[model samples]
Target chain A: MEVFIYGLARGSTLALMAVGFSFAYGVSRLPNFAHGAFYILAGFATWVFAQSLGLNYVLSIAISLVLLAAIGAAMYRFILIRVRGMEVSEIIASYALGVAILEALRCKFVGTGFSTPVFIEGTIKVAGVPIDLQRVVIIAGGVVVIGLIWAFTHYTRLGLSLRGIAQDERAALMLGIDSDRAATIALAIGSALAALAAVIILPVGSITVNEGYDVLISALAVCIIGGLGSWTGTILAAFILGFAGTLTATYIGTMWESVVVVAAIILVLLLKPSGLFGRQKEFEERV
Target chain B: MDILEVKDLMVFYENAIAINNVSIKCETGKVTGIFGSNSAGKSTLMYAISGIMMDMKRKEEMKGGERITVVGEMRLNGEDIMDIKPNDRARKGVVLCPERRRIFPESSVLENLKIGGYLASRSQAQETLKYVFTLFPALKDMKGKEGGFLSGGEQQMLAIGRALMAQPKLLLLDEPLLGLSPAMETRLAQAIKKINEQIGITILVAEQYARPILPVIDYGYVLENGGKVLEGTAQELIDNPDVKEAYFGV
Candidate 1:
């Protein structure tokens, strides 16, 4: 039961990260592999601000979110838009973003160990399980993040435009979407979400420059398992992955955990190519 | 006074003149039709006026990349709108319901309409929605449906509804009846008339089939091979022997 709570906490973070990635792909139609850079870089940034700079945890998180949002917007305007007309095989743009961020981080702080200030420095007992308060906070933050994202996509004008772009960008443009503007907005939000996840997860685990690749893989798995372009699917997949990982680690063995996940995902894919909750050409076909 | 005026406008595609020295005026609260054969620059002129086509003639001269040479002037409400951006033009009350009925395929019908009302205030957008729903009640029934699933005719109605949501002073419609059945075409035609007569929306339509459009337009221009072959009132073009021989196939 305690293990399940731990897994849920971790899965919430993964779900938030997946939502960010899904938004960009949903609206921009570009699978930005570089989004992992946001996770890794924000982790590094939070560590630096919290440990080296002696900034408070709250301040570091705020600065990280704002900085990442700005970086996302700049990357979209200066780079992504330029490579937009290029073929999808041009994953080079994302690679370029990753290289730039990694290089910049390395230059600023070389050979620094990863550490982040605790989000909450206490423990709580729930359902006969003792849980870290920070983990609970992380989980709560994930819930808030997902809720806000859902609302943003459903309720706001810019959100509607983003949804419109996700549907068909050229059509949105003819309807006057200002697509470049929409892209910038989406990138900013996506980056902010990634940064938030990074900060939330940092205190729970040590973050390293290379750890970004791992998070990237996890986010991709979550996104694919949930299905692309669907927010609700991403969240559900996150919890499923979380509990599954927990159950596997607790019952089976640690060695075969990742293997089990891979096999499970394959089985799910075979059964439903669009993911568990994804609609495969069935959403708008009725009309 | 003319709401939209295109004078000596020439659109080209790699040295081929799609629209050459074509000049026309769209009066307020009037329906004008540009009639032509398939390759006769009807869609080209509409594309030019809507700022969709690139003026390939002036590519090297301008600061922007691949300058589209627009030789003459396009004006709206006596203001030169040739230099303004397409979105800016739309905000300025000159909207186009393009030929393909470019509805955002994944968006709900209501969302599509709201996007068309991009320039309007929140309340104004709702009002526009009410107006469009009133004009095309079929769309109101499918408000939550994605546009891609709509039938060709329903999508055309949505396209026109979207343009009207912009509350344009001048609506430029390119082939609204394309691919639609005769009954659907008549339905759209009636909506176009209602927009003109009831709401007094000034409209310019470019169509290959003149029979459905001819009776409704106050004035018409006939284009052949990228140039205007004839221009007159709807009745004059209907009665003319040249028009009868070429267009009506009498």
Candidate 2:
């Protein structure tokens, strides 16, 4: 019961971290390597607002989220826009920006001593396992986020256009959907999501620069194993990795967690090169 | 009155000319056709008119790949619109139903139509959706089906329906008949005529097969090796020996 409960919470956390990355990639085919940097930045930004400025916790989170979203949009408009179609350049450019921001934060005092306050205080017993209220919030928040995204993509015009652009960019363009505008909006939303996840999940642990790299790796692992750009696949891969990590920690050793995540990615790549749900282009019907 | 007029339009991919000194005019509320074989600049002409060539040019430049050059005067309703972006042009009522029916594969039929109606008002979208379902009743039954799973005829219908959802004044259909059976081609040709007659939307259709399309077009142009070789009314084209030999397969 304890293992299952903890694994579910971890899986939800992974989902939250990866959803934004997957969404941005799906729309623009742009892999935002800065996603982890943005996540950590949100945590620190909130801490500064709430701790230093002495603002309300909720207000600090809202302001930081908006700030992160604007930063993301600016990142795409100013930097990523020039290198949009070149895959190698996109990766290099985004990763460089991410490293620059994270390293700058390191210089400023975002370390192990900094942490955000949790939304709620206390613990609850569920299925004979004691789980923190924050963990429950994370799990519920993940589901709500996923549901909202699903509805947005299905019912809203802007969301529909994003899906259209993701499927066939030129086709969407022909219909008058501006590709650059959609991509910019995608980046903004993606960044805001990363921030939301950070604010919700950071309360459980202290902030550190090292966590930036770890979050990126875990998000990448989930995205790769589930197939990049697939929302359903991301959630499924998260649970798979989450349970595997929990089992390894319980049975083998806690140090094997990272090893298991990496191994899962390697094994998935070896078995299915296009991830699990990726619609292989070569197999697509060409008439 | 001419809805669209292109004069001395020249398009080049690096040094190779894809369309050279081509001039064409589409009259308001009429179906104009351009017939050409593969690599004959039919798609290029459509892209140039729809302003998508500019987008391709930008993408190519960004990748440091081929340099695309487009030079010409394109007038829509007597106003020069060569500098407008594709989406802006779409807002100005020019929409392209692209080649191979580039419908969103993962989205359902209804969702694809809704996406195409991005620039439309809420009421316009709703009314257009109803019109599309009425025009292609077959789509109404398959509203939930994924676009990738549709048949060639159905996909082509959906493509036209999707373009109609954009509420274009001048619709550019790039090879709408590609990969369809003879019966489907004839049916689509008739539907194109009905759209023009009923909705009064000006249409420019590009195709390699001229047999089914020739009967529906008011005026047609023949392109060969990236240059216009002939232009005449549909009757004149059918009577011309060269057209009957090359295009009619007579």
Measured by TM-score, the strongest candidate is: 2
DockQ value of candidate 1: 0.26
Question: Candidate 2: what lDDT?
Answer: 0.92
Q: Where is model 2 more than 4 Å wrong at Cα?
A: none
Inter-residue clash pairs, candidate 2: none
Q: B153-238 in candidate 1: lDDT tens per residue?
A: 89998989888877788888999988778898888888888889988889999988888888789999999999998999999999
Candidate DockQ scores, in order: 0.26, 0.79
Query: Taking the tens digit of each residue's C-alpha lDDT, what string does model 1 give over A163-226?
Result: 8777755455555566678878888888888888888877777776766777778888988888
Q: Give one digit per residue, the lDDT tens place, for model 2 in B40-80.
A: 99999999999999999999999889999999899999999
RMSD of each: 4.0, 1.1
Off by over 4 Å in 1: A1-7, A88-90, A107-112, A224-227, A236-240, A260-287, B15-17, B54-72, B245-250
